[model samples]
Target: MGTFLGHLLPGSFFILYASWHMFSVFTKYFLSQRALATTRDQGGTGSSGGGGSPSTPYYRSTCAHVFPCCPRIPMEGIVKIVLTTIGFLGELITAFEDGVFVHYGNAQHMTMYFAFGLSGVFDIKVSRGPRPALPNLDYVALAMAFAMEALLFGYHLHGRTPLDVQVHMLMLYTIMLCAVATIVEMAYRRSVLPALMRAFFVMLQGTWFVQIGSILYEPLTSPWDENSHSQMMLATVLFCWHCMGIFLLMAFVGWLLNSRVKRMLGTSSVYCQLERRLEKGSATCQEALQLTEE
Candidate 1:
């Protein structure tokens, strides 16, 4: 379906963006921890290591290191702008092709356009300089995007088949989760879990969008049958299975990353010293408990 493609294109952009965000956040955390361990080994505790000065722990854009000549410019921000622009244009083209603009669905397209356009503006603002801090504007933009998506889906549900409605409902749920996660991040600035969850949801949402396309457009394996309740039930089951599959994949990748970080820490003399200190403290506490009991 053309509508499915319209969703898939922008969803793909979101998937790419979210994947990059996850990688960047985790990599920075791991490297910063390694740097701290090395600093401890060298008998320094002032947070300056890894060949750079002390910077905020929020995020260190790869662009800063990759383009040393113009460290102040925000390459990631520029990329966001370009990708969002592409997504916006795709939606506009789809609207025109479907005659949605000339008909009742023009409001949906306009809402999405504003959402993407505002997000790009926020990206440009953040990308203007180096060492950019996370801004409230970014969160606001995300809220608008998610809200608009929910509205768009809700508006188009009237004439859709049961399977189509089911898929859209799942998507709407994902968007709601994303919005909730963003709100949590805004309220709890130091929490990383919410942001990670949002990224994972974005990736899963993209996968579902593709699945929707396959179910509706692919002749060989289209499972959409309006009259058959059994078919609708199977489709719902498939959606749940897909959700679990994505979660398992993410968990496996996370476990691997954790193991790698542990190995890196194990090789650090500072980490060894810290381990010994913890053991000694535990022993002392046990001895004190024995004496008190006796």
Candidate 2:
């Protein structure tokens, strides 16, 4: 990475993607639970009306409202394509900036280019037109992304300052955790914990990049020549501060979303009716909510 700009640009994109992913996950879960509760209420009413008629299906679509311009298109897929293209372009530009292509003879750039480019292709395959029967391609792309990041860690390990090496080491661990979480999500589709953890790790990685840029750039607080015992201790403290900041941010986001969902449920007439039904000795709504929670 050249300087603060180099790291900040990509880090911003990753943070945006991570935020979007978290919002999508939370919204989808909330809406799907509401839909299930509504379906149960309808079914109960229909059953009491003498005829055993099937309840109308409530289709829960993905959150496309974030981009009002193209409600039909998946926002996540579009973001993936845009961010990955930006990443590829950034790498190409960096290569050109370094004079000759061979001058930078590092595999990190090339690996990242392939990782982002291939991920965009897979995102298109899974998201464009009709939804694919198998959307596991996205996770495969994620695994590739993680692999490329690990390769970058190898490049960082050779002839770097102690602080730089430590940062990269933490990045590698975060990326590995993200990859494992993605695999868990693929295997257990209903489990929300893995997906949430993956998003959290991605956010952590973005924050770490910001920390790296700060330490390498800003002259006043730069750890460029941090080799002394005291200097190293200060750097370690800075790292822990960054980690704590990110954790607090995550906690705030979680609380905000939880409050918003609870408010929506309270204001919803359908949800109110469902609650009344549940109070009147109906286990359907309760069971549906339990299933959705799991």
Per-residue alpha-carbon lDDT of model 1 for 1-294, expressed as tens digits? 255675567667767767665654454445445645554565664443576433222222221111223334555556656765665565566556454465446446556656766765665564453334655666677677777777787777898888778877887888778777766766664455666777778777777777777777664564567657787787678778877986787677666765666566343342332222220112232231122112
lDDT of 1 at 183: 68
Q: List the residue pairs that clash in candidate 2.
A: none
Assess every candidate by TM-score: 0.71, 0.74
Give the Cα lDDT of each candidate. Answer: 0.58, 0.60
Q: What is the lDDT of residue 30 in candidate 2?
A: 53
Residue range 25-113, candidate 2, lDDT tens digits: 65545554555565576555322244633232232222121332343355555566677676666666667544766526334755675
Model 1's alpha-carbon lDDT is 0.58
Residue 217, model 1: lDDT of 68
Regions of model 1 farther than 4 Å from truth: 1-4, 40-72, 93-107, 129-135, 258-294
